[model samples]
Target: MDELLIRLRNPHERERAFSDMVKKYQQSVYYFVRRMVVDHDDANDVAQNVFIKAWKGLDGFRGDAQLSTWLYRIAHNESVSFIQREQRIAGISLDRIAHELPSTLRADKHYSGDEIQMKLQTAIALLPEKQKAVFIMKYYDDKTYDEMSAITGTSVGALKASYHHAVKKIEQFLRGEE
Candidate 1:
């Protein structure tokens, strides 16, 4: 890890470090952003921004948290900011997307594996922002609750509650209970 940090600290080794970081975390960041935005293009854009922000901020990183945790916090902030800006410009609430999902899911059978995935995505999209953040960091990023708490600055109990609430909401959504 120290060797990697040394490589990361060198300007000439920046490309390799950046590439390694991207390779290591890109998918997690992409999916986390995608869960928030529900748009592939927007997710891609936000994921790129997350990496860019990380690269710029790398020198100042004090290693207080795992590098992955730090990157996730960046991704979370970028995703929320993107969603807020999009909501203001489009006059559309992310909530409406959740409410409309059953119809959308039923309409498209061509994408077989994706039907359930679409429902799942819709359910995730419905989560309150903080709950969604915790859920994504915990589940999608495979982060420990402790890491999630640090990244979100929420207590472990709160993070656990948020994840539980998110799961219940998703289960209800999937079952057509809500």
Candidate 2:
């Protein structure tokens, strides 16, 4: 990691290093965005924005966090921004979007989930951006609260509470209690 950072910081190696970093993190970043945005094109655009931000911010990076964490943080911010923009433009909340996810999922060629998976996704989509990010990082990525804290800049205790609430909400949604 240190070697990669050094290479990234070196002017001569910067471009190549950034490209390598993108290659290493792109898929994970895309999937993270995809889960948040629920669409391939939006995920691709947001993921591209994340990498662009990382590249532009590379000189200021202090290496206080792991590259992956930094990238995830960028991804999280971009995803939230994209969703918020979508909500504003469409004049629809994520909860309303969740209600439409079934048909959206059905039409998405990239989505291959079954009925239960769709239900889970819809439930997740209903969460506020931060809670949804916490849930995805914990439940899907199996990220530790500490790791999530670093990525989200949230306190571990708060993240835990958010995760707990997110779980309860998902359970309720799945049980048709939402």
Candidate 3:
């Protein structure tokens, strides 16, 4: 990533650098977006938009954070914007999305999970958005609270609390108590 950033700054090498960066980060970005969106096609679209936005705004990148963090931030915002836009256009709420996620995941060609995995997805879907993001980043992505705080602009204390709440809720959901 450091090498890519160096190449990114050089006028002549920027294209190759961007290409390499995309190659390096695409799967992580896709999965990150996918976890939020559920539908594979929507995830693909939002992930692409994240990369495009990153490419267009690369010149303005201030290097205050790591490239992965910047990209994750973009992915995060784009995913949220997508859900908000969907809500506006389709009159669907987050609860509706969560309610619909299981069937959608089951229908998705990319999803090969069994019933338990589907239920876990449903549980995750039921989380409030911030908690969901925190859970996904910390548990699935194995990110530290500090890194999450930087990417999400949330306090570490809040993120930890959110994660704890999310875990408890997911456990409740999984145990069929919720």
Candidate 4:
């Protein structure tokens, strides 16, 4: 991590640092964004934007928060922006959209792993944006409520409530309950 900081400090070393950063975090970022947008192309675009934003902002990064937290915040904000823009343009709610699983996971072979993951993703997709954000940060990112509050600028209680509601909604969705 110190090596990454050092590499990040030197403009000459920025490329290598950025490359290493992407290699280390890309899958996590992609999965995070994918969970939000569901569409591969949109997730890809937003994930790219998240990295580009991080790269441009790297020089100003003050290390106040863990780098992963900062990156997650960026990714989260970018996803929200994408959703809002889509909503404004199309009058469609992101939460109402169906989850878009990878083609391999949607195959007729019906891998139990894929089926369960898809169901979970679909349930997540049905959550309200803030609740979904809290759920993903807590469950998927393994962030503490305090850390999530800091990243999201919400109180811990509110974050907890959101997560709880999100879980209930997901459980209901999974159970085929409206």
Candidate 5:
């Protein structure tokens, strides 16, 4: 258990500790959500929700995992839940949303990626949600399989497989094969 975790668990010190934690983690959390959700505003809302959940759930956090791993798990859940809820409310299928992302990316002023980067993001957006998360965690975040498993509640073997499939799909998409 780290000092921050200890402080977070301590009711007396929790508020200050959580503030510190947020400052340390907010950008990473926001970017993580941003990669998944695409839109800046949507990612910001989801990131806030992630922190809100973290604040409410901090006391129940056991010291079995690192605080970052725990936070990533929360972030993964919140991002996936946000995507699912948006899909339902918009009455759009995952495939539809995925297809729509390229145009959306083109119009997003906040997205400053180059042409190649935009193409890469479009390929990533075409992935299934779990595979997309796996790809982002490994490629962008560089999380180890153990860390990814802790964050995603997935077996290491499955994570490896998912990463492999996501890579293949991205390759195919980039090559204009599918």
Candidate 6:
């Protein structure tokens, strides 16, 4: 990480460093975005935006947080912003968005999930936005609370409660018990 940071901070190595950074982080970044947006095309666009933003802003980056944490923060903000923009432009309700996900996931050529995985995705889609973020970062990404707090700007206590509630809700959803 320190080596990557040094490369990123060097003008001569900046482009190569960014390429290396993308190679290292792109899959994780895309998966993180996909978990948030649940649509392959949308996630692809947003993930691209994240990398572009990172490239543009890397020179100004101070070494406060780990690079992965910084990237996650960008991805999170971009995901929420995209959702909000979609809601405004299309007037799509959250329920409608969630309702549309299964069909999209099914139609996506990239998707290869089994029935259980599909069901789990459906349950995840049903979560409220913040809870969904908390659930994805914790359950899928396995990020610690402090890491999530850095990414989400939520307090650690709130993130813990959110994750607890998110897990219970997901359990209830998967069990067909509302």
Best by TM-score: 2
Query: Among all windows of ten consecutive residues in candidate 5, which has the lowest summed lDDT?
Result: 93-102
Runs in model 6 with CA error above 4 Å? none
Candidate 6, position 74, lDDT: 93
Q: What is the lDDT of residue 29 in candidate 4?
A: 87
Candidate models: Cα lDDT each: 0.80, 0.93, 0.89, 0.80, 0.89, 0.88
- Native-vs-model 1 lDDT? 0.80
Q: Compute the lDDT for candidate 3.
A: 0.89
Reference-based TM-score, model 3: 0.95
> RMSD of each candidate?
2.7, 1.0, 1.3, 3.5, 1.2, 1.4
Sort the predicted structures by TM-score, highest score first.
2, 5, 3, 6, 1, 4
lDDT of 4 by residue, 58-130 (tens): 9788877777778888998999888778878987665445543434346625334566678887777667777
Q: At residue 173, what lDDT does model 5 achieve? A: 78
Query: lDDT per residue, candidate 2, 1-178, as tens digits?
Result: 5788889989999999999999999999998999999899998899999999999999889998999999999999999999988899999876688889999999999999999999999999889999999999998899999999999999999999999999999999899987
Q: Could you give candidate 1's per-residue lDDT for residues 55-147 as a string of tens digits?
A: 889989887777888888898888888877877898878778677865755664433436678788788877777788888777776788888
Tens-digit per-residue lDDT, 1-178, candidate 6: 4799989998899889899999999999999999888778999999999999998888777979999999999999998888778778999877786677678778889898876788788888777778888899999989999999999999999999999998998888778898
Off by over 4 Å in 1: 101-114
Q: Residue 105 lDDT in model 4? A: 44
- Cα error, residue 140 of model 6, in Å, equals 0.7
Please report how far candidate 4 places residue 146 from its true position, in Å: 2.5
Pairwise lDDT winner, candidates 2 and 4: 2
lDDT of 5 by residue, 56-89 (tens): 8876888799988888999999998988888889
TM-score of each: 0.85, 0.97, 0.95, 0.82, 0.95, 0.93
Q: Considering every candidate listed, which one attains the maximal lDDT?
A: 2
